[model samples]
Target: MAPVSAPDAALRFVHPDLDRGPEAGLVVAGDGRLALATGMLAIRQSILMLLSTTPGERVRRPDYGCDLHRLVFAPNDETTHGLAMHYVEQAVATWEPRVQVIHIDAHRDPHAEHVMQTELHYRVRRTGIEDSASFGFDLSGGGG
Candidate 1:
């Protein structure tokens, strides 16, 4: 019999492929094997990593990241939020092919003038699973 190809084997299975962050450090599982994220957890991890990375930060894949960091000093107004949303949408669309972006929103924190809260909504293409991720951007120039 011919060898069972990887793609063929994958098609025969129902579980989604395992996910590991490109920059995430190795994690030890309870069983001693490496831990890997799967399903929605994996997708969420990927989204977080993508958002955290800055374009050109990676040596080999210089273009594999979001540019939201560039707006750190931008005015916390509608224009700034619009630019942030554009950056997020473009980054997610360009770097992550597994999910379709539904919406992106950015708003200044009512309590903190130098903080901007961003929320992202996306749907997994293969399973149609929907989820959201939120993070904050610090504009205080504290350099954390």
Candidate 2:
């Protein structure tokens, strides 16, 4: 699917300075400053951030996370994979309203020791363009 290019739509999904520069999330322009992230990039980053977080990891937002790490301990099987897909679907639906989840796929890595891969396909609510994100989680050390 064709993704909408940058600098086109109104500024959306503005995020904190993630560059980790001196100003961190803030960028300095000639006249003023801004925190980076626009359009699809911002939405993508937001999804990754949500995925990276473990539930209760955020200080004040206890319910604002993916908790995908729990799959690390689960037995590599279709049931586990199904649960993972459902979990991601629910989390994304609750946490991010800017995009509609089209499909979710979770599967075990047969070649790897203990790894699970999750693919999420989505369509931007405003643009109607499609995009996807893939995540690989290592389950060896943490749980299984």
Candidate 3:
């Protein structure tokens, strides 16, 4: 008799993957509300770091770039996104008119989108001011 395969045996799944070139233009909606997919925590961190700058501090980059900006976490959980937005809003408030948010992720972060929108709305309402700016939020991924 042949041996039976384990019910939960680990298997490697592979497909004929195609090598796509580099990405093109990337844009981040300044409306404020944003939500990322799962497996994108690193990207969220990077955005926070970028927005949060002290009086004088040098920006440093690690050897390899980090990739984490998804929003497929546990059901109805927005902790990470909330923290990120809080930091972003604080930075924006401190550096208003000179802060440009750039979000690079592998998917459209719904949490991030929503957060950004909410912050921007609040800022507009409180300050009664507006300005045009350029930001980047690169989303790259293969829809499963």
Candidate 4:
């Protein structure tokens, strides 16, 4: 079944702190109330958090996280590269609904032993602004 499209609405920057995530925005007011992050700030944090999480690490939500951590020990090859790409896409799609991923590239560093780097390109949902982030997973360790 096809999903219904949401009506076109202006992007509203004001919101409660709960939707923004665990950490407060880098900007602050003298009153000390955490200001909600907007534009690139919010998108960057969401991407980082989604990619850093492991599937089983979250309480109650066993399936909540990118599969990058699972590929830490997997043999690095064409198959592994594809799996890493899939993990990034799935995690980003599931966790951060505010942005749509445009491109994802994952490859192993030849000189750096046991390292896989993922480059992500995405656009914000409402604003249509594009940005990129690079993440590295140390295969020597168990996490990304």
Best by TM-score: 1
Model with the higher TM-score, candidate 2 or 3: 2
Off by over 4 Å in 2: 1-35, 142-144
Per-candidate TM equals: 0.77, 0.72, 0.26, 0.70
Ranking by lDDT: 1, 2, 4, 3
Over 4 Å off, model 1: 1-27
lDDT (Cα, 0-100) at 59 in candidate 1: 87
86-131 in candidate 3: lDDT tens per residue?
5445555554333343331122246554222222222132234432
Model 1 clashing-pair count: 0
User: Tens digits of per-residue lDDT for model 4 on 1-144?
Assistant: 243233322222322222344544354545674445445766676677668778899999888889887776777677888999998998889888888999999888777767887789999888899998876677767442
Tens digits of per-residue lDDT for model 1, 106-131? 99988878888889999989889899
- The CA lDDT of each predicted structure is 0.76, 0.73, 0.32, 0.72
Q: What is the lDDT of residue 61 in candidate 1?
A: 100
What residue runs in model 3 are displaced by over 4 Å at the alpha carbon?
Answer: 1-77, 97-119, 122-127, 131-144
Best by lDDT: 1
TM-score of 2: 0.72
Kindly list the per-residue Cα lDDT of model 2 for residues 49-100, writing each as its tens digit: 7876788999999999886777767777788888888888888999989899
